[model samples]
Target: MPTSQPTPWGRARGAALGLVLVTVTAGALLGGCQQGQQRQQQGETRRQEQALQAAATAQRRDLDALVERCQAGQAELVTAAAALSAAEAALAGLEQRRYSPLPRPPAPDPAVLQRYSISDQELELERHQQALQAWEQEERGRRSRWREEQRQERQRLQARLQRQRQALSAANPAVLSPAPEAKLNREALAAFRSCKRETLASLGS
Candidate 1:
């Protein structure tokens, strides 16, 4: 018995069908890979945006902390100025007593510093002639030390502020809002401005 051979048309049709299947399969695979690549790119972009947001939030938190710390210290500056004013008034009154003129003023009244929480009680003596000389020497030593301590503290604060300024170029504009210290008395506000100017000046040095 003779087996029948396939016709040319039949073979051609079979090969065409195979080619169509191969083309469809290749297109599906390429499409799947493209979708996966797009998803990866989108995920990476989202992660970067999230990281930037977190960093900005952290920076704002740090800046707010600094603002609150400085605001809390405003009362201390006002109290110090008040205490100095009181001391000056008392000295003026003492100098007017020409009949028994005291050569030196006694230690400033420590009462003025009571509310300011100044704990030093060394100058808590009664203003009298007997201990006037001794009081002067003690006051001198205390004043000198206090000035040096305050200066160092100011320098430390200024240095931190300088670094903050440099680090916060992209900080929010709200950081420029006036602090609570702005409500202080004119003299005290001026003092704060002077202090800030000193801090800024240190940046150049």
Candidate 2:
């Protein structure tokens, strides 16, 4: 009779304990799974970030050279344009001069009918002047074309430089990493120190 009286309370306590144990076990398993997943994701992020950095570093020297060449081309283009303008102005001035009319020479002697000899010299001079003007114009056109081509080349180089820089930034670990920029900055500092030490060692040897 006494055992029967306590049966309901004992059964209730066992059921409550079993439920608590099952819940705790499930929570611990779930925590483990979450931690594993987090670690896996972090490893993947690290791999991706490392690949991007390597790619950027590999291209750095080439990109720097391209930027330098582009700047030089831009300077050359500026000088060429100035020279072209000066040449064009001189050409315009020469073209504006009026063509001289043929000059009449003195009438031949009337004593004996003599043929009037045309001054072929004047015609030759005129022809030379025309040819010189044509050459100047052609030279100006060629210079202008060269200037345009240089400008286009400079623009293409600039665009390529910008694209390379943009790609480098996009692939930056600071952008992709879960760590803050400040931490990445510290890492960079450490890397720089290591590189400097290595360089010094090589030089000393």
Candidate 3:
């Protein structure tokens, strides 16, 4: 029987060895594929982390800028509050003194004098003083036709008064009472007073 086929045990051992080799080779191939897939996953995870970190950095910068603006706004509010308080205090102080000024006195009449005596010589002196003032005011710096009109008016009054004095001197005391002379003198005095007022007012009294 062909040497009993070299004992079937030997064939069995060879088959077993072949099976073990195939199994080990398959295990090594699977392990290598798993390792490659793991490396790919790790690379993708790293890329995702980097993208997240970049986005977080941008958001942090934006938050920092917003915080800075809020701080600046708070400082401005403090300044405005101080200014408003100062203005309110000033208004309050002014309100306290709003009604404390003294009342004004009445206007004085032009004919009244601050002196003690009344005489014709003194009155004539006052009239001459007024005429001198009018002349000085007209000559200082500049003049107009209005000043000439005032001068002419004063001259006419003076002439009329001179004529009245001559008439009084020539009149007889029995024929004419002094009443008419007194009336004429009063009228002339009133006209002279009005002329002084007009002159002073025209010169920005």
Candidate 4:
């Protein structure tokens, strides 16, 4: 018996089906690759965005810290300046009083002293002694008061300077050296001391 051969149409149908399966498989693989690439891109973009947000947060924190320091420094400066002015005023008053002390009693005329009787002379001597004692007492009290005031003013100035130093220390330690405001505060402290010394010398003179 002769075997029947496959029809041409049947072979063509088989070829077409095979081609359709190959194309579908290729499309599926290409879609998977594209999806993977998109996922990778998305991940990379997320990382970049996170990095930017972190940097911005850090920058804002630094700026806030700087502003706070500046404000604190300004407040300290104003307080110190007011203290300095008060110290200066006190020194001025002390100096004025020191330079112009109580007036001395005038010397009695020699003729008048001789003309007076012995009893009268004794009474005059007693009165002169009393006046001298009173003057001395007044001078001592004034000097004591002046010394006390000077001591108090010096303490105030020193305390203010100490506060300024503390403030400077509290500021950004990341900065290697003193800032301009700190330098200015130091200069002010020096000037205050110099003024105190000069005023004391003037008082002494």
Shift of residue 166 alpha carbon in model 4, Å: 18
Q: Which stretches of candidate 4 lie over 4 Å from their true place?
A: 1-3, 75-205
Error of 3 at 116 (Å): 70
| lDDT for residue 197 in candidate 4, whole number 0-100 | 40
Q: What tens-digit string does per-residue lDDT give for candidate 2 at 59-162? A: 66555554454344444433433443454454455446443333333333444223323555455556666776776677777767766766675566555544
Q: In terms of TM-score, how similar is model 4 to the real structure?
A: 0.37
Query: Whole-model lDDT for model 3 versus the true structure?
Result: 0.52
Task: Report the lDDT tens digits of candidate 3 across residue range 75-149.
Answer: 443343344345445445544542222322333344664443557547756776777666666555244454565
Position 28, candidate 4: lDDT: 100
Clashing pairs in 3: none
Clashing residue pairs found in predicted model 1: none
Candidate 1 per-residue C-alpha lDDT over 1-205 given as tens digits, one digit per residue, 9 for 90 to 100: 9999989999999999999999999999999999999999999999999999998798667655645554655565545545444544544554453332335755565466464443443334433444787766877787777667666755665555443433221122122234422122343344343445343233213
By the lDDT metric, which is better: model 3 or model 4? 4
Per-model CA lDDT versus the true structure: 0.55, 0.52, 0.52, 0.63
**TM-score: model 1 vs. ground truth:** 0.37
Question: Once model 3 is optimally superposed onto the true structure by TM-score, how far is the C-alpha of residue 66 displaced, in angstroms?
Answer: 1.6
> lDDT for model 1, on a 0 to 1 scale?
0.55
Q: What is the TM-score of each candidate against the true structure?
A: 0.37, 0.34, 0.33, 0.37
Measured by lDDT, the strongest candidate is 4
